[model samples]
Target: MKFKFSIIFSFFLYITYGQINVKGKVVSKSNQPLEGAAVFFNSTTIATITDENGEYQLTVPEGKYKLVASYLGFKTVEREVDINENTSLDRLNFTLEEEDSLLNEVVIGAKKKTKSKKPKYEDFLVFKEAFLGRTNYAEKCKIDNQKALKYYFDPATNTFSVEAKEPIIIINRDLGYKITYNLEKFQIKDRIISYFGYSQYEELEGSKRKKKKWKKNRKKAYHGSLRHFLKTFITANTKEEGFDINIMHRVRNEKHPSDSELAFSKKIFEFQDKRSVPINFNKVIVKPESKLDSAILIHQRQLKHPKIIDKLIKRNVSYSDISYRVEGKVYLKFDGFLKVTYNNEPEEFNYKRDIKRRLGVQKSNFLLFDSPQEILPIGQIADQNNRLVEGYWSYELFANALPLNYKPPKE
Candidate 1:
């Protein structure tokens, strides 16, 4: 099975009782109002289109956010705002510059018609598994616009990449959401997959019973998720929330053969057996053409283990151990990986069976690429590039995604 990781960052917002009013006007370079411009906070469902006067108003809970203004044919603009009770909402205004139409036309014309190829079924399958994920929720989700996708494969690098001509639309029946994803980048190289994008979510209309089911499903998706973990950690409620965090130390496995050694071994084996067919040089495996290949099979089994050591539990972790507060802002600064187990929920049977682990808890692994990474009050990482997630959180893809503004229903 291929291990996949996604790097998705989008605008999201959450509403609370203590709301701060934010109003803004969008204009052109000449100071003329640009009507119908989109004004919203990045990563939040709270968005509005400017009226005829090119003015928009929003009420959001006090927090730090990236305010954005976008208009067709105009360059998108983003501004960092620290919203609080004392913030001057009226001062929030934006000026958008028109995109160079001539440059856009030139870039479009540069693309060769012969190079454009229709996406194959196999390509879509790969894209779907990487994007929508292989979760049960993903099975109920469908991409509405596959035609917007463009595919490319490089045999030299063994890389497959995709680009979107327009926003990809998805209808998630299980989650009751209509998502519009602006896919900025997607690529699969050297058996590792990564994608990035911004998204807007619209709640699907449904019956009262269906809405109730959606609420329950959303809550299930939220619990034991990355968002829940972050929120619980920030509030110092790990124990109360049934989260067990521990330090996991990982290091390179010295027993793993280096690339040069593997290449040398391959050459020697080929010289000894001319009929041996090399299956994969990366794994140093060859098709057994003779009884002497039994030795190679034994070697392959030894090499099948991971290059990195796992399950090296160091010690228990506390909230203060991984994070600190600076000037009232929360920042995460930690070394090594955090192995978090949510004891409140049991691991899915499918996952448990696949991993062959009897442990009933849901577990995930997290690593920080940068120390002192700021975490917003709403449990969102200020800098997405500062952290890496693996295990369960990484497995749940766009199909299980909830809007930033989504709030758990009261029990």
Candidate 2:
């Protein structure tokens, strides 16, 4: 699971107060000024370059952010900043150390020997789909550096993993943004995929008409999205934002036989049917040879009657139903699954066909892996790993991602 950094922006401060000025200096370990060092907040476009004096400044809204300073041939430095009414902005400074290039070279050399074999075409396809996702915008998104990716497959566990030697450059013509993604980790196992990365977006140059089209497309992508849902949910405006919330209870099927019972039954069937007799088995006592057979049988039964939502606990849920306040901080807590329905927009054709939902409404399922997730004022979950999502939200991946600083146009 990706670690989601939750940033709580002071919406009240943003609307009525002036921006905060953040000034900082970047110096080497030897106290030498580092010129042309890029200083910015991770995953946002709020950035500046250090001058000859290694001084950089930025005016930003009050919020919690991961500030980063990067220069070529030096290790990047990151600091967590909380800019509020009492923050002393001038204290924000960074001292970077030189990176060990020789160690890096040795590691790269060893990796090359072990992973010299080229990846199969089919493997690349799987990697692409899992990383880029299957949204409409993903169709127009292209990864510019395929060679930078290294692939490994473990047939024993049926796991596929990928790593990038450098930042992956992606050009999204539809959204009019060129993105640089620093992929940290990516893996696919047991039909579950997880990838963590930081992204920086640069606006693409285009004609006036083309720019207008991109703006419209970006807005379309933002609506009915997870971010939009979170913003509305925190503001207690789900209904106004065309969202309907419901509590769904998933129960295990009682009719499903236990693994031991299945194993006993399988032994009986094999003995009675005289199918594949064991080498040293007697008629009085028959035992399964390995766990693999039992696992396969259990999996087959689960497919027939998997754990399913048996009931709806409530409908038209309000924000208070799933949230609580402690010392002025908000946290979302709920039982079972959260069934979210977006009524304003109909389901896409691909989604409908693949998910096999005939209803035109857009519906998604939200499950809490870790309960009582903190909710920031900016509509971001403080801990991203705490929640698991399926359906519509799961379909929208990096292709539909927007910067944390993205703001919807005023209605």
Candidate 3:
């Protein structure tokens, strides 16, 4: 009887010790206080956004809780913790990995155009038009100024460039900006004449290409006639309006053994596709929490890096021409302003507030800044107002020409 009573008492003690307050300060990789970091456990609404000091306080009934910490432009962190009563995890800090804005860089042959086949220049121009046309998509109505930038495509090198006129990133959902352009935009420089060498894409039917790959994959081709139609659709019309965007996403949780976890333990994503349609992934989805609202998920991802490249191409901002070779990718020059929090003294410019002003001016028909030549001017304007406007002035050309037979191997 005595032994049983002792055992029961110990169990009660263990239960009592499990409850506690978990307190911590969330800082960025640079040791900067991460204000507004979302500290939550699992999918529960039991959550709190970090304070201006990058500090948070949470009460948990000890067990294993999936602790997620996130901020804009930063990677999302999911951690497991077992707490005890009266335990104060003071300085329990979270570090977020910075995101690489550049997507993929490839190189393709920059060959001359020939008459027997479609000139490489014509394909390049078609690609350019499809890329630029994406900017005009209706999604622009939902743009957020702070996260928005003008993307330029260089025709000669097939590089994508970026330029920012404003410094603030708006956090509203309908107003939040997207990361990549809906499609690629091509800029034309000097015309290059070349014959089509390979018929890589000639096999795909037009309708098949138009349909989402996932959808087509799920529903296999039924009739030979349908398959034939697909082939014709993709190849029949060289003059057909061409545009496509393909974005692949993977969401992993360590608890879920089937899916592999990411190395360095942060969210990693890459969006690259060679389709000829304007696919803005603006309404994109991220996994495990895909069911969760995007505003919340994307907002959490933003903590690491506040500056996200606008994938939407703006003809007014992009280079006048662009073309790609098979297996080639290019990086072009960009200039823009970055908004940083003031840990020391408040810089004269408040990026969050200034973004609105910049947007307002643009709406009022004010030319806020120019490109290449005006890049310096935009930064000067932001600096004059006491804000940070770092220029993205240079980039490398990964590939000037991409092969017609572009196929991304299965992951």
Candidate 4:
């Protein structure tokens, strides 16, 4: 959780910008123009409504964006477009199909159980604060339509979940980006919140001054971010990147899981016919309550936060460092938690932005980001399961996100 912003904080002067025009229209599957449709580029604030003739125009910065066409009771259409200085005659047209239904809710009970009480207005607010994020900049984000979201809370498991049929349109005023999120799953349990979905972003239009401010804010937001760390990790520049990583091997306590984990371990053990075999839940299941729970526990305290633990039984296991393949895909090969810390002292570069708030305590072995391996080895990363508690990384949310096409400038 303790990470430096110095190395990753510099402004990305290499980012491109230019006012580009994108014209388009939304129509029905039968080719009839659909008026009043919501049309906008994903991840940007630049948006407009379709005119009576189903025509629309969006002026935005030059970059790759996902064009989204949506209308009430119609399936949203999304298209990717690259708008650059050389690009000409860029037209984004869409033919949307009517939605079968707007009611998109999931029921987990085997039988059709009675519905839970409707979520209160306050409940929705809490959900928004958690989902959109609690960062200071996250306050600028707004969900265009809240009614589009459906919430369900189960008392039996004390769990809360959400769903949406259409992609949730989120406009970030601070970042000047529009995000269209197709929420697949979201749930809150055990004081932890976890959700997964695909999303696309579009650049929103801003004045010269606002753009300058956004550029500065983005640099601060991007520093010490998951993406930034990953970029540095792949290149084996931890020290240069202001990160100190101390890896340790897994030492299973002679004791088994504590009372509850042990009980859950029994459930999995009995399911496996009492075999003393290592189970591969996501290849590394740290939480007994994890949806992918498949094995018994070796030590109840194995996943404790790295900052709180001292005198770790350092493992001498050898493995390749996190690096990239010939094709440039990052690959991770490790055995234990990479307890990382921000070695660089905080600089007075931006006194206002550096002021510490309730960013939560520094934790270790935390997964920086999701990779192809849906499940990570618990031994390799602390808090591999449960609600993945992010330290300062939580502050660096989607607002600071950049596309894969971005390549950092040479130092």
Candidate No. with top TM-score: 1
- Tell me the lDDT of model 4 at 1: 24
The number of residue pairs in model 3 that clash at the backbone is 67
Model 1 whole-model lDDT (C-alpha atoms): 0.74
Q: On a 0 to 100 scale, what is the lDDT of residue 10 in model 4?
A: 12
TM-score of each: 0.81, 0.79, 0.24, 0.56
> Under the 3 Å rule for N, CA and C atoms, how many clashes does model 1 have?
8
Candidate 4, superposed: residue stretches over 4 Å from native: 1-70, 76-97, 102-106, 109-119, 164-173, 178-184, 190-192, 197-209, 233-236, 248-320, 343-364, 368-389, 394-411
Question: Per-residue lDDT for 1-411 in model 1, tens only?
Answer: 535364657443433468878998999999999888877776567778888888999888886677878776676777888788888888799999986653213222345222225447778888988888777789989999897777776555666777766668899898888877667678777766787766667789999998988888999988888888888756878778788888877887677766665665666677766866554434444576653354455456446756788755666678887888889777887778888888888766545433545757787888887777877667777677667777777777778878887877766
Residues 1-411 of candidate 3: C-alpha lDDT, one tens digit per residue: 000000000000011225467788788888898898777664232457789989999765654444667665665666656555434467566887764554323223553222113354554344333222122122232323423444444445643333333222221112111221111212232331111110010122335444355233222211111112112222332112121211112233323222122221123332212333233334445564532233334434444333323232332221212111123222112333211111211212212232323321011011113322211100112111221112100000111111111222322
Alpha carbon lDDT at 139, candidate 1? 90
Give lDDT tens digits, candidate 4, residues 1-411.
232211111111112467778787789989899998888654334678899999998887675555677776787677766677776634578999986663533347763223337656766785685576556577788889777777777777887777776778888777666777666566676666666544556777889998887666666555555555545644556567666555654454534345566566657656666556555533555555752253323322344322233334343222235433545334554444455555443422222243445322232344333432221111112122322323454434444455333344444
Q: Is candidate 2 or candidate 4 better by TM-score?
A: 2
Q: Clashing pairs in model 1?
A: 10-43, 11-42, 11-43, 11-44, 12-42, 12-43, 12-44, 13-44
Q: RMSD for each model, in Å, please?
A: 4.8, 6.4, 31.3, 11.7
In candidate 1 the C-alpha lDDT for residue 355 amounts to: 59
Ranking by TM-score: 1, 2, 4, 3
